[model samples]
Target: MVVGELGSGRAGSTESPPPDSAAAVLAGLDEQQRTAAAAVTGPVCILAGAGTGKTRTITHRIAYGVHTGVYTPEQVLAVTFTARAAGELRGRLSALGVGGVQARTFHAAAMRQLRYFAPRVLGGPMPELVENKLRVVAGAATRNRLTTDRASLRDLASEIEWAKTTLATPEDYPARAKAAARETPFEPAAVAAVYASYEQAKSRDGSLDFEDLLLVTAYALEEHRDVAREVRGQYRHFVVDEYQDVNPLQQRLLDAWLGGRAELCVVGDPNQTIYSFTGADPDHLLGFADRYPDAEVVKLERDYRSTPEVVGLANRIIGMAPRRRGLPGLRLLGQRAGGPEPRFLEHPDEPTEAAAVAAACRALVDGGLPAAEIAVLFRINAQSQVYESALADAGVPYVLKGGERFFERPEVREAVLLLRGAAAGRDDGALVPTVRDVLASVGWVEHRPPPGGAARDRWQSLSALVDLAVDLVAEQPTLDLAGFVTHLAERANAQHAPTVQGVTLASMHAAKGLEWDAVFVVGLVDGVLPIAQSLNRPDAVEEERRLLYVAVTRAREQLTLSWSLSRQPGGRRSRPRSRFLTGIAPESTAARRTPAARAAVVLDGAAGQLFEALRSWRTEAATAASVPAYVVLGDATLQAIAETRPRTLTELAALPGIGARKLAAYGEDVLATVAADT
Candidate 1:
């Protein structure tokens, strides 16, 4: 069994771990890791941040347990949150000379138990499980006389899963949805009716759904003492990965399995909890101390994946999130050798942003970075159309991640159909106004729907087309509907190219748990990343911050963050960079520069911003060293540095007040701060 309790900082080397023939498993582990692997005490909680070798540490700990005879390989069960993660665990353990340990997802393990116990408990064969839960949900919607379509049906199915996973019964779904401020696809009562009818249909067919595996297994364990004793005896030790994502029902299953024992070690990071819509709660990991009272918590903050620049940027982003004061040790100290400071790019419009990102990816590939090792991640899937076209136009290969290409989406297809019809007779007048009416026919709302709902996602996809129309019209003012339709066809044909050896294009959510050698996180405007739906909600905004943190930590070396000021060129410059970047993007948060603060020497936009940042950095640096600000950089040199934006030591040395001695003291700092303003 896992042993120990909370709050003892930094594991000391005073105690030696038990020896094993496979003792080499403990070698190369850092002090904190060695302590975690050797601790033979109560339930353990590993606060593993992104890029930290939490997976390696846990595997070695388990392998050490087996080698030392503290654990029998056959009796240990490792539960992960995904099938891929579980497979990796088994593979890692096998490489460590440990085998026969059962590694499975919660659903997989419970389903196995149900296969064994359902027949005996029911005195008959198991009920036939539902092959497609969405089909059942659609059938139930038909029974309720509801007018439904494919997208809304998908949204309803997702809401049903949330309700079920959070343990809310159909009778209570309406109240629960209200309590959670959820935006259901249908009216609340209608949603509840469909949910109730769906449950009835399942009961009538004698069919169990996927979610039923967790509920039934836990019920059996709680109702039957024999089943509890059997499961507890068979698997004497349990280790749960991604514990931050455990919902109420999963936690219920975990509690039933434990039966008041403490043979559990849960590894997770509260800072990376971004799946709140699916009911993932960070508190489960945050409050581990209160739950077990005797749990041992280890903070795994050494990040071996990213360079110092990347880790430092990630830390600053999370530091500004709400309720951050309550959590400590969330900071990550980089372990890898230094790499390039992350680049921040600004563009006049989204088309420019997408094209610039594509050009950057192409340049990286041309510089000898493998194409497959690069990725372009955005806030939503709808933002991919421009990138797809841009990459195809640049002769760069790419793949759409998690789903079909943008032009293949159902809503996009319908909107394109409407646009085709408009080309025949309705095409007239100003192009932008005429196109907006066409898209509005397909449910493009003036205000976007709330976050975590299908309506918002559908809106994003449709709205992208409207923005496309804006860009197209600005480029060719006389172009009518027929010409735009032809343009769409050309772009779609280009996107259809065979795309196996290319960069990955995914939303921030899909990019989690995966790393890239070079990552470009685009669309860093206010309404996109935090999303318009989450602005007023503090909790939701915090989750958005966590999502950005996830995106930042995905890079192994080169990382770039970018945003556009408007949807089209010559448009208003009202769209500031994301406030989360308050950032390296100070213009996103600070007030306009006072007339007095402005450089007496007028400079261009980019140079002006860089000069202010350098001055700010100089003020702080001077105070820390008890020196005059000019002792580091006079205003004239700061302005010169900003105007030239020197990238290398030679460039800085050519400027005033910068020689070999000064470059040795402050060259890298000047370069990095200048890079931030780009």
Candidate 2:
């Protein structure tokens, strides 16, 4: 039985307790949730898996105790990660006929206490709270003579956040970051210097950043007994949701709030702890049993969100993860009936993959599923463009989740403006090179900077535009810079600026705490899924697997996991499916299937001679474009052309890999070259 968000929306009588109100809440709950809700007291830990109704169980537990006269709604402090989750908990509790319970994010709770205690402890009103860290971080970066572009500044801000959340001092940042293998856009020392400057600037301005709210509140509670007693007296019972995401600083803050007592309840699944970069450590959640040896522990395994098939896939993927010591590999026992088996598909390139996914999403929408019940999730934000274009072209409405659309991003808009300006003036030389050159004026480079930085993010946005130019030129060789600008405008207009009440397109991180009827997880290739950054770090690859676990479980009925063999058209097909799928994907037998294995005698034929000539031509074209030889035309396409000996552009266009753009650009040359040889 599901009790929380999955349960009924009816509110109970808030005026007076129905004697059974407390017991009635327990009627539909499963045994585990009943035990958890019945605890009602200190030192309780609920090991809740995905879609297992953790929210429901906890809310019912609070309502059970409140109605039973064991807990006053005001005394129970329920803290979560986000405001939306807290609001949700409040609404759920209200629906269950319980009110006055304080549900809030940790920051919100800290800020409230800080404001109250600041006058007494620090002898003043609270310092002004700054909502954004970018301006301060940019000023610090400027002081340090660091690259202060919006992207670099944003990345630096993230670094500063990680350092502060982990309680790393500015002086300790370089060493601690190194020990932890933290990725930085700039050198460690440089980041440390900027960190010190930012902190100094905040102090001078008498302003507090978000992280400081927790820090200062913790300090006050630790240093002043009066403040601790008053605050702790006001809130006696504490519940922390998503406990696995609690970092050391937050734990310290929580410890302060608890006032050295064990009056606490933590509900979380360690497997879903994916925010380590933000300094979230699962150790606190994993070791809660040991911390309070007498804690009432309950594992909520019955998953109400997914089918048995989806649950099986989720279980298998997470099963392969190298276990963290003391981490319970909570297997979600599916409570729902079996559904269709999840699909695993492969596409030649990113565009085709997006188009295929768009078609699949359209099919699902046509099959009586609401558009909002479907989602297209990918590894990163840069992968959204092709999918957005494909979905828009298919006339499917969609909304970007947790982020703005790729084309609407500021960096992309700036780059497009730069291109538009360039097109307004001088010659619009060759399409791809002209776009590349114009973007380089805005700091675009041939090779991407390190991944996981604001600079890299900005570069990716610009690179998407370049990719669009490449793909556009491939289909329309005569498209000038002005024409390309017009094309981009048309694509943006068709989006309707992210239509509401539409399919969800989001990054995997953004999809957490959300579920859909049909989920299409796209771009599962090597450097993408595991991501290039995770390859070298200790146990980082396993975290990537856990990320996939999160993505896969977001589906209730239909799930499609797909990867691109190559990134773009004219790209090498050397990429393989993510290593995580090694045991799942079928084994390849290229040696047994290809005709090349026939014999060496075939090389003596005229087709063989012509194949070599075409291969030479491919190599020359590739060299001119500075791309792989296969990008011009794969071996199979060259061989097909050699065997057919097409004499006209029309005939050349008839073959695979020879589209309108390719024919327009290479048709005359190819026909002339073939006529000279044939």
Give the winner by lDDT. 2
Q: What does candidate 1 score on TM? A: 0.71
Give the TM-score comparing model 2 with the true structure, all chains together. 0.73
**Top-scoring candidate (TM-score):** 2
Residue pairs that clash (backbone atoms under 3 angstroms), model 1: 3-41, 3-42, 4-41, 4-42, 5-294
Candidate 2 lDDT over 1-678, as tens digits, reads 122210112333256688888779999899888989998888888889999999999999999988999886777889998876887788789889988788888888888788777789778998898777898888898999986788888889999999999999999999999988888989999999999999999899999999998999899989999888888877889999999899889999999888778889999998888888889988898888778878777888999999999999999898887767764568889999999888776555677667656756665665568787899999899999898887775556677776667667898889878888888986559989999998888888975543433555576567667877888789888999999888777666433231234688899988998899999898988899898998997577878888999999999998888776677765766677888877765543322434332111112246556766776777788899999875676554564465457766655655555677778867787776677787
Q: Candidate 2 regions off by >4 Å?
A: 1-15, 404-499, 588-678
Residue 515's C-alpha lDDT in candidate 2? 93
Q: Give me the runs in candidate 1 sitting further than 4 Å from their true place.
A: 1-19, 324-327, 404-500, 586-678
Clashes of each: 5, 1
Candidate 1: lDDT of 190?
92
For residue 584, model 2's alpha carbon misses the true position, in angstroms, by 2.5
Candidate 1, residue 346: lDDT: 58
